[model samples]
Target chain A: MKKSLLFLVVTVFILSMVLSACGSGNTNGSNEGKANETATNQPNADKPKDKVTINLVAFAQPHEQKMYTQLIKKYQEKYPHVKVNYITTPPADYATKLQAMIAGGQTPDVFYASPENVSFMVDTDQLLDLTPYIEKSDIFNVDNVWQKGISKYTRDGKTYALPKDVGPFAYVYNKSLFEKAGIPTPDPKKPLTWDEYISIAKKLTLDDKGNNPESPDFNPKKIKQYGAGFWWHEPAVWGNGADYINEDGTKVTIDDPKFIESLQFVADLRNKHHVVPSSEDESSMGGYTRWLNGTVAMFPMGPWDTAAFWDLKFDYDLMPWPSNNGTWGTWLGSQGFGVSAKTKNPQEAFDLAAFLSVDPDIQREAMTMGLQVPNLIDMAKNDYLNMTDKKPVSKQVFLDVIETNGHDWAFEKTYDREWYDLFNSSVTQVWDGKKTPEAFVKELQPKMQELVDKSIEKKKKAQAQK
Target chain B: MQLTEKKKEMWIAYLFILPLLLQFALFTVGPMIFSGIMSFTDWNIVQKASFVGFDNYKNLFQDEKFWKSLYNTVYYMIGIPVGLILAMLLAIGLNRPIKGSKAFRVIFYMPAVCSLAAVAILWQWLLNKDYGLINYALSWFGIEGPSWLGNETWIKAGLIIMMVWKGVGASSIFYLAGLQNVPKSLYEAAEIDGAGKFGMFRHITFPLLTPMTFFLVITGLIGGFQLFVEVVIMASNGGDGPNNSAVTLVVYMFQKAFNYYEMGYASAMAWVLGIIMFIITFIQFKFQDKWVHE
Candidate 1:
């Protein structure tokens, strides 16, 4: 009887162990189901009474993060029944992390989309078309925002995202450097022509012997201060009335004579004119550091650097970019909020995206904090240009560029990433003086066109399948 | 009854090991098989994959950049012997009964454990063309230092130098342990027979250290081929150095996968790299008996 009892006890213990393990596994499976059901049902079934939680993600700078946090708080107070989980990722890792999250099926309801990413996101069918929502919104009028900013995110007559900011390039000049060089600052309203700008740059540049480029005894090797710095090829190319792509986005036109002329002029600034820092110097010291040390007189910068520039010890002001073809011209950068197509509550997500992007108060705050140039034209003209406490004396330059000179920053709608990579890699040779502009462009044009054609074909096939 | 008891105990043993076996199958082995299949398809992560058998490999064979990157990777491996020599010398120096030998070992090992990103950043500043400490020191000797990181001809050499400096410590530690294992009696017996220090090292010490040298060479070759982080950090603005001179096979694979969204091509490149590594390691093992003592 005792042996039978012991056997029964052992059997029961083993059975209990197996049953407990299986029971835990079943609970884990059910827990996942509960999470899915809650995520799906709560936003739709109990919309009137229960809170609707929506996740919003953005890659924001420090000041932008602070502005977004405040705006989100104001939004939450206005809509008590809606809960927003705002997430911010650093700019460096934002795209990679967002792409992984999207592929892994954990899409955020609303996210920030840069101009470079708009076509990719749209091509992948990740974004919700905002045209319907925009038509219904009484306050969100497209005409109120900068047209370039709005058009950047629009494709095939449908808008994928709302314009949050417009970044137009302008010259931010150090007043102290100009005074020290005994050169007058260029007028904000009337930009200088290329030759006139070069003459002024000659006056500003100085060698260790205090000889300007125009002086007979000047030595390029002994240069201590550069007159200007071109951060990218955009301002020069656009100012020359040339572009990388055609209007229909079907061809690469980088081999145009005007574009080659612009590139030659840029190369001359360092190699022939010796009025700008060499590539090695720029890479080592960086443009910002050179500007801070008063070694550079004029820097072509976007409006986003206004706050950082304001803290510099030297006095500074803005001016329109120097014209190459008798017209002030530059490129426009835009980034805005986009809603994901995978959202359960499309209406609420669209509302949050609109509030974050189109609200006049948020736009004004973003402008005042130097996080953006206001996307709203009226706010940009009146509030941004005439702000009482801002350090820039000529904020009107940015607005003027946006109104008259800004073009969509030379990116094609299809095959943009591939074409841009090729162009950028090829142009490095031009910038490094290994190849002339004409030779580089001639070699790059056909390669870029092939990619564009392939992308168009792929897009057509994708559309046909859909 | 006894057989039943043994059977139950065997089942319990399997139950304990099942978790580990399941983990290995799910995580490691599963990805290995999946990646092998993925190499034969055209996948861009977001799109559905279609079979494109052998096309990726064919394109890889014709790709100029792939050839260039492979050349650069082999160029980087030239540092292995340079590193091994320095490591062995340090190990011999430290193995002696000298003051603060323990502290010296710790100091040498520190760089091996230090963060790679931090090391790369430090080397970047040290190798800068204009304002680097190295150039400043060279200036004191009236010699203008060449542009180390910027010049295409010098960038790979610069990388190899940094790799050797960062890796020598760990390799030397292994050599030190091996040196300790060489019986002291052998050294004493050789000395009593009027053998010089050099002769004793040639006959007794060097022969026994062959196994350690063999281990270091095999591991070093494998590690040399996977060089990525240092180049990435040093050339963060653009991963490709001047004229793409610093581009390595793994770096190219990463760029293709993440930046260009060409996952299938990247997978194929990865598989090719894996095959190359396997063949090389197999060759080394085959010849191990000629050089390495038991």
Candidate 2:
């Protein structure tokens, strides 16, 4: 018993010693608080500016964070007078920690701000007015950004933030598959009219033709080959110009005539049209694998899906999202460089933001990953598409989607969160087939209006106190 | 007789455990006081917590999610107690003076040290619908297995099975310790009297192990209520666990505080859970007064 107790004591001692070493090894090892006196002194005679550090917090994945870190390091190298204090937060708990940082009076010098909480920052005047910064750096094209994203960020005609990706849905077909189906290529120039697209889908939908459309024996039900396969929701719903949230980023638009119509169209492709597979079928075969397995001829997705498709080793052709309202629309998402108003040096902060956002190399690397749409026009055409890098993805989709059918997607309004969740929750009712589209929309309208009014009053009171 | 001044001073000195008192005040007492205060207010990381008074507590009472989580906890309480009783029975059986009985003890204790997290995950794999050990074994019996974790009705059963497997060894150890204290003299006395093996066990050995049984039940209930790791990892994103059939209250509190940033609501939840746990332990103690041999 005594020997066992002694062994346990040594074990605990070793465990705690290792834990404490890991505990303090983080911030101190990063040399975060150290002053680079040698480098600061070398340029002292010519430039007497004191070196300053800027804290930046982000909720990006490791690879995405690595890109951001590389940008910061390059910026520090160029502008020796500046140092970057970068903190990579896990995507899950970023908002909680960020809020704590804000309440403590010292937020990151440059950090990611969300559309949902931008109003919170604006309410407290804790965000920098980027108007002047944008004017100074013409390379940061403010006008050419997707209109819908700008609509959400722009409160009372002042933009707050931009995104790295806007979820724009497109029909990616196997050019080889289309050729095998004997469906001549879709007009690359025009994409397709809604009628033309669906008719083509119906025609190319069968390996075991019951007859022909002309022969009155066309059977869509028991087709051996599919004309197109949709991954149920998301791009399909949003592709039809139906949004989850309104343009203001506040209200959910689930019951919108257009939105319900979109769901009906996809559901009809299964139930009514007998074209797309049922939810049960898709549940068994995962979306990525379904297309990769050559079971589906045409797959539907957003520009963000390019990396997944590239990794799957499929020969594919791209088409712009099918049009509904005479003209096609692409919902755009993009990321922006935001300078915290709490920065001790706002001008220096803006200068660093410019250096990071406007740098050709930084924009090039981001564009190569197909992770972000570069805010700059010139640097947007990056060259990492043709690399022998570990996993190289084509940047052409990012460029082409923007060049052809991309449109600014209006973000839903950001106001009362629960009220919005309730509206989004109501979609599950329609999805579960309990409520009709018209009734669901009508039933929830009053709830939405009441919450919107409450939000408006809350914002009014908050502003008045400020 | 009146106590001498030196005698009183020495006795008082014995009561003053300075280092322990200081440690208690700093870590335990300090946190308890702060948590009590926090329970009454909205202490979100953003913006000064405008004191919402009892609003958070009031909302928690009416929330459907809170009630569901409570139901889940009750399910586990019923489950673990029943399983622990079986473990005690097994330990008693294995404690017999038979060949290779020592080997059985080592085998029983092996699971006690195995990480519960790894066990939870491994059991989830075993209970998986398409490609699991349990279902695969069931296939040999020509039996079709249900989606254990995916289905709400089956999730509680799956969690119970995992808990029992992970927990059996620990309870067995406690039973073994209690069984050792059951004197051989009592058994010898019963044998001389022509009382059978069953007679001795029923009257004495079982009664004597009541102290250990009570301890296990109390600690097991407390530990079961704090179930989060398995629910979070195995269940869908939020431990809502498909139809929220497996959402324990503590998991709900974590979701509210961390996921949604409703700290005021979370604090109220934490206090409510603490009160529930206290009441449960109090009831167990009250019952133990009647039944515990020690």
Candidate 3:
């Protein structure tokens, strides 16, 4: 009896293990089966009697996901024969997960494309060139989209994706803090020069002893509040009329005297002027939290963060980026939807992408959610910036920056991820005050130039093959 | 008939083990060999892979970031000894028949069982420079705390402290089990020989616990070399800490693979790390017999 019992227990254990393995294997098999089924259904999709399924994936926050689901439902109603499988991945894991899926040959029919990933996707032939689709469609017009948003997804004069949103960096200031310090609120119409901005920042900054930074007895060590912070170097550099790369993008000009001076001015905000929090302080609390807590007077943020900032207890408003040489500037960030090259239904995928990007109703819904600035010029102005109930009180500043001062970074066009990794890693030292900007730029310029040159060569080689 | 029954049972056993063996072969062993081959190429996931001979390895040798990451990984191993000592001491203290020892054991082991991401976030708050619990406590004694996560000089030390806090409880449980296995008669014998508490621990209890020590040290070193999650959580903006102080070998490899899409370079890094781990573990096994009690 005991011997038989042992055998029975052993058999049960083995059976369970085998059953679990088969369970996982079955799921993978089913996925592959579905892919094959989709492929077969594509050709028959043109027939009025046949049904087709298209897979679409995106990374979105909870609110944004709900909006996307609603939009997809509307699209399905219009195209009753089409079945859509919408997948949403969280932003943190989206890139890695999408890359794995594409590499494994289960590419989504449509997916989100950002400036960072577009070049890689194009080079690998993962994205379908949408130039022909746009040219043929009566509803889709490339000129209707903002030029800034369109340029981000274009390569070699061919558009690959339609812009879903355009995020222009603008100055966000705590109005309550400025009022408390007895300073006049900054005018959105007039851009503050560097000295004027610094003087105001000095007044807003306060030490534990309630002394301003300009006071002779001000204690930097016991600072209770900071005046301002610029999140990225681009705003400071561009505001000072210095570009990191020359206009032609042939070489890095980070070593330009104007750029170096801008860097020093920013560094002095912490070290010498004592009007801004040190890097350590900023990392600990974050600029947004500090602004919400009324510890910071001014911070630069994109439109995407406006929704989150809406809940702040203190009064706040947006303004155009401050000017240095009568030219205000900030970086423009754009995200859009692209059709996959491996997609079985290119027409359906393009339809979905175009609908998500250019449709006025969907863009208005996104603006209402405070998710993004509308990518369409007319919609962004008439529907969003001119909206009566907008909370920020200066929502038009975002549109203004996009229309006048916004530009893409030099590396965005030619350099890939490797170049960015090199630049970001080296620049952190300068940000942390471990190295002077002059020394850092001088030492890193050659390395950055080499990466740019290598990228150009690789692009030429790929073009030759094509 | 008896021989047939024996053969049938043998077949059943193999059948039961087959699933587990197959899983191990498919997931673990398959990836290992594939990655080994991939390490010799110049492949980004999207691009076509081309055979580049030893170029990936050659580039790794010249990579300054690789060297810095290796240094950071080794530096992180300092937590092992610190963790082991604290665990052993706690285990010894708790081994005594005392009030509420069971509850204390559970309380201490809580951190080990808690979700790693949650624990890391908790530690970030605790180590915050301005209004954190540690600084708050320090202020009462008229001492200001240094910026734990912000300053490069203290970031590694801060990470080590967190590791010890999280690991000590689980490690002490292992020591406690080892302590239980030790014969009570040895302590009686030592007492009869007029041995004091220190003498008894040093002579009788300590020798018996060497096996557990050996186990923990070897495993700890392996775990130490792959430190990624805690640093990633603490430094969420950039996975690399201020001035790249907290970038370990595994984290760098992850950035290379996922962020840069350099599969070939990442694979080469993984193999290099694997070989280093093998050598170290081999050396440990060779030397363990001298100190580890049977």
By DockQ, the best candidate is 3
Write candidate 1's Cα lDDT for A30-103 as tens digits. Answer: 67547656855665564655457778988887777887788888888877777888888988677778777786
In candidate 1 the C-alpha lDDT for residue A401 amounts to 72
What is the C-alpha lDDT profile of model 2 across B126-237, one tens digit per residue?
8877667887898999998766776657778878877887778778888988898888998888999999878987888888988988899889988988998878776653
Model 3 lDDT tens row, A290-393: 77777889998778887788788888898777778978888887888999998878998899999888888878777887778887877877778677666688
| Interface RMSD score of candidate 2 | 7.7
Candidate 3 ranges beyond 4 A from true positions = A1-49, A246-250, A450-466, B1-17
After TM-score superposition, what is the CA distance of residue B45 in candidate 3 from its true location, in Å? 1.3
Docking class of 1: acceptable
Q: What would the DockQ be for model 2?
A: 0.16
Better of 1 and 2 by DockQ: 1
Candidate 1: lDDT of A2?
A: 48
Report the lDDT tens digits of candidate 1 across residue range B1-294: 898678767666765675666568767787778778989976666666677899889989987678988999999998999998999899999998999999999998898999998999999988887888888998999998877776667789888889998999999999999999999999989989999989988898888999999999989989878889998877523567766788899988987777666678889999999899999999999999997888
What are the TM-scores, per candidate, against the unseen true structure?
A: 0.90, 0.75, 0.93
Q: C-alpha displacement of A108 in model 1, angstroms?
A: 1.6
> Predictions ranked by DockQ, top down?
3, 1, 2
Per-residue lDDT of candidate 3, residues B223-278 (tens digit):
99898899888863456777678889999898888776678889999999999999
